[model samples]
Target chain A: MSLDAVPVAETRRKGDVEPLVRLAGPDMAAVDALIVERMQSQVPVIPMLADHLVAAGGKRLRPLLTIAAARAAGASGPIEAPVRLAAAVEFIHTATLLHDDVVDSSDLRRGKVAAHLIWGAPSSVLVGDYLFARAFELMVETGRMRALGILATASSVISEGEVLQLTRAHDLNLDQATYLRIISAKTAELFAAAAEAGAVGVDADDATVAALRAYGLNLGLAFQLADDALDYGGQSEVLGKNAGDDFREGKVTLPLLLAAARTRGREDAFWDRTINKGERTEDDFRRARELIVGSGSVAATLDLAWDYADLARDALSALPASDWRAALERLADFAVSRVA
Target chain B: MSLDAVPVAETRRKGDVEPLVRLAGPDMAAVDALIVERMQSQVPVIPMLADHLVAAGGKRLRPLLTIAAARAAGASGPIEAPVRLAAAVEFIHTATLLHDDVVDSSDLRRGKVAAHLIWGAPSSVLVGDYLFARAFELMVETGRMRALGILATASSVISEGEVLQLTRAHDLNLDQATYLRIISAKTAELFAAAAEAGAVGVDADDATVAALRAYGLNLGLAFQLADDALDYGGQSEVLGKNAGDDFREGKVTLPLLLAAARTRGREDAFWDRTINKGERTEDDFRRARELIVGSGSVAATLDLAWDYADLARDALSALPASDWRAALERLADFAVSRVA
Candidate 1:
């Protein structure tokens, strides 16, 4: 289809894909189709549950990093490695989501009922396990021990991050350092591993691997910060979840932590009622949101996200100027700017 | 210490293994210490919950298979592989136990509280996931893909078997073949994998690996059958569980299924009260046990267990007359004769 004929809204933002879509020329369509095909597999109820998320249509940012990283490394061909790499990333993400839903007893995910709610907790748990195991099998079929080691280590870190989160839940005493540790383990580690292994999948050298890893790490941090911002900012529609869900869950994210710190003595009753006691009424959410918004923590959090996004861009500067590299640059913008 | 110094009561049974104990020597002590050490690492409430089951004290059959298989392969140094192997098997077993308790909503395990009962369901679920991930990492350090493959495949089979059990639950129409598949996947697969991987860890030859696998498989099947028989034979103390707990859970084990078949026209009411309706009272247990025993299914089940035990012994017949092999032969007898 001609670019002019494409739907304006369905296309990424105005500047979002304009530069990179031109740079991508032809391979981007193939990459997108490859991801979809790879996502389709028969694993009892797991595949159906996964499709709910995979097709719920979040930006496929991790796989994009993978393909972009492969291309930025100056490798060219109908190389199947990138496809498997993309599939592996998706699998890891899907597996984590399945477990996350169970861990949180979450009812809604991507604007749909969570897998655990739909399929029961046991099926959801086993399916998550199945996907993780299958992801390992995919990596093994790639014939790279380095890739296996990278992915396996990331999976362990992911689990650890989750445990850390579980431990810290409902604790209002949590700080930015602990929050950062959780995000790095829970989210950024997989992002870093995905980009690192994407380059490694094509035998990218140490320098390239390091660059892509840094890129993914920064981008992932920024991505999660933006997610926290969205949670408080009432960007519910684009984010595909309810506004103030985090506050309801009593999670002390950056905004809440900063707001609580700034108010210190004055909002002790608010913190006690919302965070510690978990008795958040609508008035509580409104008051909390107003407090966080008024304290400038929302913009401050966004500032940090932008800083990380800029760092992510800087990490990509070492790579050659290619369409894939340009697409990655656009991705940092999309990740930080999206309501989701 | 000399063999005579060890307790005679622990070695006087029909399947007694004074020889294997002597061969194991100090290593048996080391393995036991490691088991306790590893079990203690489950942090706070988890460790307390795990201790309940650990102290309930299984035969440690899977770990013993690991040790014996390694020894049978003529490995004579650095028992870490066996130690690690045994630990990994226990971790996998413990993980499954946690999941099984959740799936079955089981209140008692070995006459003690289930992990889910002691810890909340979510905590039990995550701890199970933790143990599984820990087990994988430990096995991965072994650096043998074949061993990892065996274990990963067994884990998948276990999940599949559990799902099969779920789907077949309360369905009295289930046949012998499906029942065998369920048990094979849920029980024997892990046992076989443990033995085979133990052999693989020590670089056992193909023939030895095959023999150990068969031995473990037969022993596991025999062990489960004996457990089923005990449910009908008034051996609650030996099993560390209530007599006819399987019937209470609406599980149609070999003895129950055979009796149902023999009961013919009476099967409908039995099925209604037991499997389908699931309103099993003390009287229900009494009548079920009576029917199973009176129909001679318990004897038939015991015969089947003996057949597997004999097969396990025959599998070891070609091995050189080593103390380890002799211990394994005795283990086959013990597995069937334990009545649990």
Candidate 2:
């Protein structure tokens, strides 16, 4: 299918997402099919709950990075292995969201009720495991040891990061170093593996694999930073979840962390009350947003995102010029531009 | 090492467990080490929570089956592949236990507090995922896609089984056929995979793999049947879980399903009130036990277990003669004898 065949209304306005779909358009459709095929089971709840979460509208960005990275790595044909791995990548992400909702006790996901709330935490948790197992099966079908190792390692890292985030949830003293470590393991690790697996799927050279991993890692960090900023400032439509979710949950993202850092004297008490102690009113979220913007942490967070996005773009220097490569660069810009 | 090298105290009265330990003694030690090594992580809760469950003394029957089956299939050497696979098998089992407890809302496991109760359900859910990922990584490191495929598929089947069990939980009308299907997927699938992976680890012939799978499938059926019986009749000290755990959970195991089938009139109402409606008085358990025994379901369940054990023993006819072979046969007897 050509870009010309795509309906004009369906075109993504986001700079990063557009190039991703445009370049990997045909392959992603196949990946989508594979994902749907593999997630089905004789057990009804597995499909019912899994499909509910899948339909909740995650952008499939991680898998897109996978397909695009593989194409850029010289497998330009309609190959099946990377497409399978891409499906696996999406499965892993969806599994995490399912488990995280149970962990955080969150009711909302992607503008819908969380799977745990709808089907019960047990179903969400088990189906998440099912998807994860399915992910490995797909990776194994890739018949690539490197891809398996990268994903398996990423799964462990993501879990570790989640546990770290759980432990450090409301600590007013959460340092930037700890926060970075948490995000690197929880978010960036899978992103890095997703892209690296794409290159490795085609047996790309070590240098290319390393470059893709770096690009994905930095892109993941940028993506997460932008997510943090959006949590405080963006609308529910843009956020895909309710705004001020992090505040109510007392999650200390960069904007909140930075804003707390900059606050002094009387302002420290407010941070302590709202975030540390979880004492909040309907008006408290407005006040928290005001302090977050007033202290310039939102801008600072976007700046940090921009810096990471730049790093992500620079890492792509090793890849040869291609539509896929350019799209990845644009993805870095779009990640930060969401906050803009 | 000879059998005399084993200490007198180490001899197991159970038909199967002794020879497994005696035959695979040295390699199992290595598998234990791998389990410990792979479970370690920088995030404290992962290792902390995982180790707590590992130390709680659930018999490592699943991993031992993998190692012993490998030995039976002619890999007698202290090869790292089977050992790693065995460790991976244990990790998968333990991870399921962690998640299953959360799903079942059970408070105790293996005479110790379940991980979900201790660390919270979310931690168990997430850490279970970490261990699962670690399991796949170990299988991949074996450089055997077949092994990875077997384990991964088993994981999905097991999750499917868990969901089925959840859906059918309070339905006293659940039949022998549906119950068999659930146990086969949830319990036997993993056991079968564990045995088959052992054979596949040595690149065993198709005939050999099929024989091993058959052996494992029958053994798992026998084992679960005995477990159901034990839940009704055995002591907590013997079962390693509380007696009447199924009764309290209202889980419709084989014994209960059979008893419910046999019961009529007022007895039917009793089961309906207890199992279906979740209304139980303290003395109702005592009366329920009497009804189950009087109904002869325990005897019938044990007979069914014996039949499966016979099938398991028969499946071993394909394997070459060895001590491991004899041990597997004895293990089959021990499975049925547990209920007897």
- Which model scores highest in DockQ? 2
DockQ computed for model 2 against the true two-chain complex using alpha carbons: 0.73
Clashes of each: 0, 1
Docking quality band of candidate 2, CAPRI definitions: medium
On residues B1-340, what C-alpha lDDT tens digit does candidate 1 reach at each position? 1112212233223675455667676665666676566555423554565666666666667877888888898888776777777777887788788878877778777767777886667666666765666666666666666776777777777776776776674577889888888788789888898889889888889998999999888888888887778777755556666776788888888988888889989767966677777878878888887777777778778778888888989988767778788888888888766552
Candidate 2 — which residues are off by over 4 angstroms?
A: A1-14, B1-16
Weakest 10 consecutive residues, lDDT, candidate 1 chain A?
A: A1-10
Give the runs in model 1 whose Cα sits over 4 Å from its true position.
A1-57, A78-86, B1-13, B17-22, B25-57, B79-82, B110-112, B232-237, B240-243
Among the numbered candidates, top TM-score falls to 2
Q: State the DockQ of every prediction.
A: 0.29, 0.73
Q: Kindly list the per-residue Cα lDDT of model 2 for residues A295-321, writing each as its tens digit.
A: 787878877888898899999999999
Q: What's the TM-score of chain A alone for every prediction?
A: 0.89, 0.94
The local distance difference test score of model 1 is: 0.74
Q: After superposition, how far is residue A224 of candidate 1 from its true place, in Å?
A: 1.5
- Cα error of candidate 1 at position B45, Å: 6.3
